[model samples]
Target chain A: MTSASKSLTAETLIVQEVAPRDGLQIEPVFVPTEAKIALVDALSAAGFTRIEVSSFVSPKAVPALRDAAEVFAGIARRPGTVYVALVPNLKGAERALAAGADEINLVMSASETHNRANMGMSCEASLEAFGHMVAAARGTRATINATIATAFGCPFEGPQAVEKVEALVARYGDLGVDGVTLADTTGMANPRQVADLVRRTLARVPAERLTLHVHNTRGAGIANVLAAHGAGARRFDAALGGLGGCPFAPGATGNVCTEDLVSLCHEMGLETGLDLAALIGLARGLPALVGHEVPGQVAKAGRPCDLHPAPARKAA
Target chain B: MTSASKSLTAETLIVQEVAPRDGLQIEPVFVPTEAKIALVDALSAAGFTRIEVSSFVSPKAVPALRDAAEVFAGIARRPGTVYVALVPNLKGAERALAAGADEINLVMSASETHNRANMGMSCEASLEAFGHMVAAARGTRATINATIATAFGCPFEGPQAVEKVEALVARYGDLGVDGVTLADTTGMANPRQVADLVRRTLARVPAERLTLHVHNTRGAGIANVLAAHGAGARRFDAALGGLGGCPFAPGATGNVCTEDLVSLCHEMGLETGLDLAALIGLARGLPALVGHEVPGQVAKAGRPCDLHPAPARKAA
Candidate 1:
C-alpha cells in the first residue's frame, strides 16, 4: 500500500523540509503565520515531497509556533506533498489531525529525565500514549510516526544506552506506527555511536520505517548522518537553515542544516533528489525572518567548488 | 634526540597554537608587541605547550605582526613550551633562528596556483628551498616542520588530488622534517574525503609524522579531523577561536577553532592535552586585539551540556 513512496529509484531522494515547525519554534522572533505559509508554499514548489509543517505543543512551551492551526490552513500544499505535524501528546495528536495534518509525529525522549522534562511524561506513559495515538489515528490517511528523542545523548543523562533506545523502537514498531525516528537532540553523539545505534535499530525496524534526525551542535551532525547511512538507514529529518532545537534543552542549537546535509549527500553520489541551489536559496531566506544568523554555513557561503574568478580586475 | 617528541603520542593530540603567527597576520589593526607578548605568555601559562609565537614573513604583507621580533623577545617562555616561528624564506628563517625560536615552520601550498598566490613560489621551488632549510636546521635544536597548504582543497583547483598530497607527504618525509602538516586551505573537505585521504596517506607515511591543519570555512573542519583520526593520522595544527585565513583567498574564514576541536576530541576519549577552558579564555581575549568576534562558538556559548539556571525572578 505504501507503493515505495512513488518510484524513488536509487537516484532519487526526498527532502523533508521542517523549517516552519522546527525552525520557527526555537527561533527568538515569532514568524507571522502568513510568512510561515508563504515559506511552506515556496518550499512545496521547490520539489519537497514531505514538509513537517508545525508542532502541536502548548503555546506556553513553544510560543513561536502558536499559529499552528492558521499556518496549516494557510499553505498552498502541492498534491503529492505529505504535510507532517509534530504531536507531543494525545491532545496534540487530536489537534493536528483536526487541523488537516496529513501525518502526525509523536516524540518522547529515550532518557528518563528528558522524557519527563521535554515531554512531561514518563517513558512508560509516553509508550502507553503512543498506543492511544495509534488507535486515535486509525482508519485515517494521517500516518503516525514515533520519534525516540535523545536516543544518541540526553541533556540530563549523558550517553544513552543503545538497548533502551532499541526497546523504545520495538515498542513503537509493535504499536502499528508507520515509522520511527531516532533523534540526536543534543549534538553529543559521535559517528561511531550513530553507526552503532542505526545499524542495530535497522535490524528490528526496517529502513523504510526508520528516520534519523540529527543536530549539528558539536559539528558532527552531517558526519553522523552519513555514518548512519553507511550503516544502512537512509531516511533523514532536517530543518532548512538548521532551524530547530528543543528550547527546554539549553545550549542545544537548531537541527542539522538541511542544505549542508543535502550538499554533502549529493556530492558523495547519494541521490537525495534535491535541487541543491534551490534548497540553499530557501535557507538564505531564513535568517531575516528569524532575526538571527541561521547556522547553515552553505546558505551564507556557496558550495566549496563554487569559485568565481576575481571578476576581471577592470582597468587594472 | 627525537625520543621526547615521539613520546608525545601522535594519536594523543598536541595542538600547535597558530594564533600568534597565522591568526594575527591578516588583521588591519596593529596589535601592540607588548599585548602580543602578553597573549603568548598567558597561553603558555595556560598549558599550550606548543605555540607559534610569531611570523618571520615580510613585514609589508602583514603589518599587524611586523613586531614579531619584539613580541618574541618580550614573551616569558615557560618551561616545556616550544615557541615556533613561520619563516617564508632563508632571510626569515635566519631571523627566526636568531630570535631563539625553538622550532621553525615553512609552508608551501599543494596547489600550484595557491603556492604562487600565497608564497610567490612554485611547488618545486618551495620543496627545493625547504630541503635547504631542513639541512640548515640540522646543526641546531631548532626543528624544521614543513606545511602543505591546501592539501585537502584549494581555491583555484577545486579538489586536491590525493595522489599529489601523498607524493608531497613522501617528499617531505624524505626531507627529514619533523612533521608534514596537511592543510585544508579552504574548507572544501567533508568527513568521507578526510577519511579516504588520511587512510591512503597513513599507509605510505607514518601517522605520527602527519598533521592536519584545517579551516572552518564550510563547517566540516572538526568533522574532517575526527575522520582523519579514525583513519589513523593524529597530529593537528590549529589556531585558537578559528582565527587565521589565507589573506589572498577571497571570503575564507580563519583556521579550525582550537577549543571546539579540543572539546570534541577530549569528550571522545581521545586525549588532546590542551585545556579547553583555558583555550576559550585566550580566544575570548582575542576580540579586543583583532577588532571583531573571533568565530569560536565555545567562547561565547560554552561547551555542550554547560547549564546555567535562570536567575531567580526578582519579586515583581
Candidate 2:
C-alpha cells in the first residue's frame, strides 16, 4: 500500500484497467477463460498499477463471466500490479479471496428503483451486506472497494440525488473500505455535474481513495473524466476497447476507452505511466474476441503525432 | 445581422449545421439534390441560425457534392437562417452567388502539403484564389468566409504553428471576409491547443467572425469545442449524425455530431437556440440518405432525460 501510494505523484493519474471484469462481463459471448487470463497478463505488462480481473457473481446472473475463478487462478500476477475482483456478496468475496484477489469491489445502485432492479435489494440492505463483507474481509489480505453504481443517474429514476450518493460513500468510509468508485453507469453525467459532485466527494473522501467510472453512453465520458480530474480525482476506471455496458441502464454504451483516455491524459501533459501502444494493440485485438469493432477511437485514428506521408500527385 | 447578433448572448452559443456540405462532401455515395434540400429546410426549421448548404467544387473532383447547384437552388430560404456554401475558387463563388447563397465559405489548408493534396495548389495559390473570390463576391449580397483547413494539424505536416494560423486569419481579415473558420480538418486537436489557438485568434478576430470547425477523428472533438467556447469562440460547425470526414487526412473520422454537441450545450445550460428533438429526428433520418448507420450517439442512446421503466421483477 505504501509503495502503491508513493507511485502516484501529483502529476501522475492512476488508470485502473477494467476490461477483463467490467468490459467482458457485459459481452454476450463468454470469452474463454484462457483468453481472459491472457488479456490480464498482457495488461499487467502495460504499466498499469491496477487491473480488475473478473467478477465473482452468480453464474446464472452473469454467465459471460462464469469462469471468473478460472481466470483469476490462471493469470500470472505481476509483482506490483494490484489485481481486483468484483464481489456481489459474502459468498463472492469468499470465492475471490480464495482465488487470490488483491481487492474485492462491491457494487450497489444509488437509486432504490435501480438497486431493486439490478441487485434485488434496497440501498440500506446493500450497505448492510457490504458492512458484513467488510468485517469478513478484515481477516484476509484482500482490500474492499465499494462502487456505487448509477451514482450519476439511473435509467429507471432519472437524476440521482447527491445526498444519497454522499451518504453511501460516508457509510463505506464508516465500514473502513479501502476506496469508493462513483460510476456513471448509464453515462448520464455532464462535466458541470462531475466537477460539483467530485468536489463535494473529495471533502469527505481522500482523492487517492476515490475512482471515477464513467460511461460514454451519451458521448460525454472523456469530458466528464476531465471535470472529475479538475475536481481532484486521481484514479479512473476504463476498459481496453471501450467495452462494457450496464445491463440495467437502457441504451447504455461502453466504459470510456482506455486508449482514448490515455491519449487524452498524455496530450494534456498528465503522466499516466502506461504504454499507450501496448494498450492500443490490446484494444485492436479485441474485435477478434468480441466479434465486432469496439468503440475505441485512438486505436483506429492513431495518436495525434502519428503522421502520414504526402500523397503522390497524379499528372493533372 | 443585428438581431442575429443580439440572439447570441454571452450565455448563448451558435451551432452551424454543416451536414449538407462538409458532412457529405467526403461520403462515397452522392445524396440526391432533393434530399439535401430537404435536410437543409428541416435544419432551418429546427432553429439553426446558420447552415452550410453545399460546396461548389468541380464535379469531377468531388462527385458526392456535384449536385451543389441544384441543392442551393432548390431549398426554400428561411428569413432568419443564413444559408452558406463552400466555394473553393472564383468559379465556385460565382456559382454560389448565382444560386443565391447567403454566404460563400472559401477553404484552403493551412499546411502547404495539405493545401496541395486537398486543393491541388500551394497555400499561397489557394489564398490568392480565395482573395479573387472575396473580391468577386463584394457586390453580390453574398458574404465571404475564409476557412483555414488543417488549422490544428496536418496528416503530412504534423502540428501547425499558431503563428502561421494567426497570420492566415490576419490575412483573411485584411481581405475583408465576413468570417474566418479555423478547421481541425484531421481531428488532430486537443482541448489545450484549441483554447490557446482560439484565445489568440479571438485577439485578432471578433467572436462573431470566428467559427471553430473540429472533427472527431481522435474523439477530442466535443472537448475541443468546449475549450474553444471557454476561450471566447461562440460559433461552431457541426455535422448532423457526425457525417463528415477529411478526404486528405488518412483515417480521419467525422466532424463533431451536431445533435451530440447540442445535447452537451443544453445539459450545461448554455443556450443553443436549436430544437434538440427536431435535430435528433433529422439525425435519425440520415442513415437512409447515406446508406449506412451514421456516427452520432444522441440518436442511438437518446438524451440523458429520456427515462426507462423499471423491469418487472420475477419471484425470487
| Candidate number with greatest TM-score | 2
lDDT of 2 by residue, A67-139 (tens): 9889988998888889999998889988999999999999999999988888888888888899888987898
Give TM-scores of chain A for all candidates. 0.93, 0.96
Tens-digit lDDT string for candidate 1 (B18-133):
88877888777888888899889888877776888898877886788788888888999887878989888788888888888988888998888777777776789888889778
Query: How far off is residue B114 in model 2, in Å?
Result: 0.4
lDDT on C-alpha atoms for all candidate structures: 0.77, 0.87
Candidate whose DockQ is highest: 2
Q: Kindly state the number of residue pairs that clash in model 2.
A: 0
By summed lDDT, which 10 consecutive residues of candidate 2 chain A come out lowest?
A1-10
Candidate 2 lDDT, B17-104, residue by residue in tens: 9988888888888788888889899999999888999989899888999988888788888887889999888898999999898999
Off by over 4 Å in 2: A1-4, A7-10, A246-252, A314-316, B1-3, B246-252, B314-316
Q: What fraction of native interface contacts is shared by candidate 1?
A: 0.14
Q: Write the per-residue lDDT of candidate 1 for residues A213-259, one digit (tens) a residue.
A: 88876556776777777787767888888787655444445788788
Q: Considering only chain B, report the TM-score of each candidate against the true chain B.
A: 0.91, 0.96
* Docking band of candidate 1: acceptable
